[model samples]
Target: MKGHYRKRGANTWAIVVELPADPVTGKRRQKWTSIKGTEKDAQVALRRQLHDLDTGKLSHAEKLTVKRYLEQWLDSKARSSISPRTHARYREICEKHISPAIGKIRLDKLRPLDVQRLVDSLPDKGLSRRTVLHVFRVFHNALERAVRLQLLSVNPASAVEPSKPDQADIAVVDSAGAAKLMDEVVGTRLEVPVALALGAGLRRSEILGLRWGDVDFDDGRATIRQTCQLVKVEEPSAATAKKKTPRFELRFLTTKTHRSRRSVTLPPSVVGLLRRSKASQSERRLLLGAGWQDNDLVVERGDGKPVRPDTLTKQFHKVSDRLGLGVTFHGLRHSHASLLLKGGVSMKAISERLGHVSASFTADVYTHLGRGIEEQAAEAFDRVVKHER
Candidate 1:
């Protein structure tokens, strides 16, 4: 109910606080906390503890280690609130990065320096700056939940400054380059999928997850319902008792965001390409008969199985390398937006077509392409002025 501090060393103090008596036994209770700072800081800490007691938010310190707490968090809070892929990623970050660094430290005793050291040592461990930032964020989120649950008085990660990654260059293709890519993929397995990527602005996952039912040849639109992802799962090998081998399995998950589950109009050329692909698949299905798997994927192998997402990327890389396009498969999506912008499409329309969360986000990603549009606008304005005069 009340608290006070006494100097234990040169700048260290012990804060002792009185607690409500035990219910049945009527025994007195007290909690002690150590502060390693000036007397003023000790006073502030005591006040905070007392306030927490008054508000029924103070909890007894436990001997829980960071590793144990993170495991519990991932199993309970994270599993329920986040997607399975995200939960797995968070657990991987904890195990591969944070746990090895400071997992043995007591949760309540974790300090800002400990967290900073973990972050600072990551680049030396061959982790990218982006990866380092991601690890910090995952650890910080777990600690934040601990604070909300009254498990700790503060989150140590808040005091640490994470390294910022440099801005990544966005690769885009011009009209001529897009034409070259299209021509290179003609009569190849990537033909229809590449057309969908460039013409419909579909993400790679969306393209692979597409089904025949989702496309409307008559309407020239395709509904994005799900995305395909390759997830790593643990499989126990028969030869080993306690050893687990990680294997990847393809999963069809709901679209990344609500806006991502949208319908995009297909360009006429893309529609024609899809029609030809459909007829080709139908012929293969009949030829294989019962031998076909028949998953009904829009872009699949000849045996009617889903194409591996990585294979799609590698194949695209091969074509791009040969053509010297210098653009990635994902860059096809960027090229779609760039072409639309240069063709005088409205930002809102383009955003919706690409299933972006907002037009502002679309603009931010395509800001590099704005210069050409600006020049075109200035020329139009000049023409209008001369005609009016």
Candidate 2:
């Protein structure tokens, strides 16, 4: 009967431990340890918890629902350490889908089919595949945390089929198209960050996060160190539109992957473009006076605030529409990868330059370009054999 566990509720099992409470307040809080399973399973859990207590891993039980725990996870696990944009994404998924369905479920009772049901409801609820998948990831992450905290023994979301949309072809504005885009950028109101996207194939954030110090004009090299994210903060008061400051402020942080923090050599033309851009940014500093917030190098307005990464994308789209061109800003990044592959650069080299986490990832994304280059190589071998014979 020692270390005997009692079924508290649902899938939750616990061992009751009595502790003195405040007699004045008449609040005698029940001290219970969380476990998940039958009596036999509880014995093993009891040993683990006692072992954890001996080793300093056992903590208090919170009868927290999936919804409450998710909020705690986001605030503690995400908002405390991660980028603002990332927190926004986690919060959005929790609100739009996960919170609505299984958020009320106890953390211990979450099942694989429960996760599947969440994904299955998306289409009927008019949510996109991408949104549904994001929600799934959030739910998976929550369950993963529960396992980490020893609240649950398994991750249910891992067992379920993920909602993957019919993927559209990888977009690329080919070499000639890229050149056209760059030329148009030069003539338009688009800034240097915009130019960098088309010319160098830098992502919008990478371009906007670039500091003057990161740019090495003499060596034509640039180092990626940080990303600028729009952190969302609650606005307490209704202020005048003109007087309203940003509810979301830019916070500089590291790249998503370690490889993303890389140094790349820019072409001479791109270097010149950056130099001009730098001078323009300097002029803005003088105009903004005390209003400017400087973080160096990233192409921000004269006021020193970094531009939202998507602002460049929206601008690029507008320009493309004006020029009667059909292209996404991301197409420029794809084009860069294609050009590298076509030039016979090894996937590893291309992966590093593009900040890809793995060479396999590079190979997967640019498979079409690699296939074309491989075909050309085969044709070259055939030509050489016939000529030699």
On lDDT, the leading prediction is 1
Tens-digit lDDT string for candidate 2 (252-336): 7788777888998887888987787777778878988888887785577557777776676788789778866676777777778
lDDT of 1 at 102: 96
**Per-residue lDDT for 376 in model 2?**
93
Global CA lDDT computed for model 2: 0.73
Clashing pairs for model 1 are: none
Q: Per-residue lDDT for 1-389 in model 1, tens only?
A: 67789999988999999876532234677889898999999999999989987664675334568888888888774447345678789888999999999999987688899999999999999999999999999899989888876667788899999978775678889899989888888999999889999998999999999999999999999999988878778889888969988888988878877889999999899888889889989999999999899788999988888888999999999999999889999999999998999998999999999999999988877776887799889999999999999
Instruction: Tell me the number of clashing residue pairs for each predicted model.
Output: 0, 3
What are the lDDT figures for the candidates, one per model? 0.87, 0.73
Worst 10 residues of 1 by lDDT: 20-29
Instruction: Show where candidate 2 strays beyond 4 Å.
Output: 1-62, 187-191, 237-247, 279-295, 302-305, 386-389
| Model 2: residue 128 alpha-carbon error in angstroms | 2.7
